[model samples]
Target: MADTITLEVARYRPDRETEPTVEAFEVPLRRDWAVLDGLNHVKDNLDGSLSYRWSCRMGICGSCGMTVNGEPRLTCATFLVDYAPGPVRVEPLANFPVIRDLVVDIGDFMRKLPEVSPWIVRGEGTSVEEGEYLQTPEQLADYSQFSMCINCMLCYSACPVYGLDPEFVGPAAIALAQRYNLDSRDEGADVRMDLLIHPEGIWGCTFVGECTRACPKGVDPAGAIQRYKLTAALQSLKSFVLPRGPR
Candidate 1:
């Protein structure tokens, strides 16, 4: 129960420094304040030059994700008081190029997201006039858990596979693809199969399960990837056994 705590924040200025460096700043350690709040204090009161991304202070925006003490977490959800009477390390997310202090480039994730077509694709003749697609409770349950992903990129930070192989589609995107794939109203599953089955797709996952562990929203990307693997394997077997013509 100390009055203040030291935050060792990472600083990187492309114009000046070739690598990142840590800078310490002491901020009030209120029980109600979160790690994000401490960063805000540093930016507002101490140094305006510090840079990071944040919005909606609530965890829903998922923009405040950072490496807090070597763990990927939503800064808004991580209470500052939990670190107790000492210094806490804050840095940009791992496995991504640091744009600045505690801010990493997310261009890679944005580019890969569309490859899976995370949406509901229906038949060409299907029209809105046909009425909205209705779903039962059971149907909704199939993909409900995956739908919680807020695209925080914490999964990417925690994924060692992505660190080793940046070409991998990563976890959140794959999980989102599965979310729509499981939707009863969606017909894009077949279209996305090629991407998911690619070497950089679901196959890239080694089932380390760090992505699921880092998710604040309870979206289990590892589970989704594993499930997709089984489905893909079965489809491959069926294609091998069945004739090329329509069955």
Candidate 2:
């Protein structure tokens, strides 16, 4: 096994340069060391000026996501030993505006999140004495897969739809909407239906399915969109067949 590996990390200092550049740093190619571990070594020992986002290092935080070898991945979960024998390229997630180096501005995602009404909604809340809303295991399984989303935005990074149209609301937000929509305890699906059924919503998805391929948590945004599309079509059929009352 090689003792060392070269990491070509992307650097972007808006004040320093108009475009991003790569700076290489040789780091120990330890079997236990992840790509993120190499970056930390560079920051702590070689270059203190290096900038990136990381927390929990266990892949739960999802803040350490970056494009490694042109594929979006959790840097902390991708071991350096996997890309042995030479240099590895790491860059900011594609599609989103770069904030600094490996950190891309998530403001776009943040802004679009509320549009889906991600939280559980109800017409009325149960009293404190009534306890929290309860669900059977069967009901829990309905949306459980979507609930695994860590909001990593790797889906957005992998989405060609979002890259073509920034207004498309992206994958994570839509999957989260399904998270609450499928929840039996939540009654907000009606409120979200109009926004989701819009042209800029699920229709924007071309079903490339790269979003699902890129998701670290295994959340299937592409499947959610397809399900929602079927739902909308059924709704349209019902409305056409059964007219409104007293109209």
Candidate 3:
């Protein structure tokens, strides 16, 4: 195994340069050390001007996401030894405005996430004293897979539709909407559907499937979008056939 590996990290200082540039640094290539560790080493030992965002080195914070060799990954989980014997490229996530080195502005995602209302919504006249909304294990399993999203934004980095159309609601938000929609206790599916059924919502997804492949948590946003499309289609059919009266 190589004793050291070179990291070609992207650098962007808006005050000084109009475009981002690459800067290389060499760090120890340890099997236990991740890409985040290498970047930390560069910041601590090599240069102090370098900057990035990271918290909970265990990958829970999802703040350490970056483009590693043209692939979006959580640097905290990407082992440096995996790219041994040569240089590894590290850059800020794609399709987002760069804030600095290895950090991109996620304001767009933050704004869109709340539009879907990822939280559970109770029906009108429901009281908290009505006892906890209990659920069976089977019921919990329905949305549990989609609930694993940590808002990493890696799926956004991989999605082409979002790159082309900034107005698209993107992948994570849609999956999160599904997370709530599938929950048995939630009564806000119709409310969320108003936003999700639009052209910028479920229909925005081209089913390129990159979002699913890029998800670190196995949350299949593509499947969720497809499922929502079918649901929307059926709902449209029902509204046309069943008339305005209650069924």
RMSD of each: 1.1, 1.6, 1.3
Off by over 4 Å in 2: 243-247
lDDT for predicted candidate 3 compared with the true structure:
0.92
> What's the residue-level lDDT of 212 in candidate 1?
93
List lDDT for all candidates, in order. 0.94, 0.92, 0.92
CA displacement after TM-score superposition, residue 142 of candidate 2 (Å): 0.5
Estimated TM-score for each candidate: 0.97, 0.96, 0.97
lDDT minimum window of 10 residues, candidate 3: 238-247
On the 0 to 100 scale, the lDDT of residue 79 in model 1 is 94
Compose the digit string of candidate 3's lDDT tens values, residues 113-139: 999999999876467888788999999
In model 1, the runs with Cα more than 4 Å from the true position are none
TM-score, predicted candidate 1 vs. hidden true structure: 0.97
- lDDT for 17 in candidate 1 is 99
- Candidate 1, 1-247: lDDT as tens digits: 7899999999999999999999999999999999999999999999999999999999999899999999999999999989988699999999999998888999999999999998888876467888878999999999999999999999999999999999999999999999999999998888899888999999989999999999999999999999999999988888889859432
Cα lDDT for residue 172, model 1?
98
Tell me which of candidates 1 and 2 scores higher on lDDT: 1
Model 1 / residue 3 / CA error / Å: 0.6
| Best model number under TM-score | 1
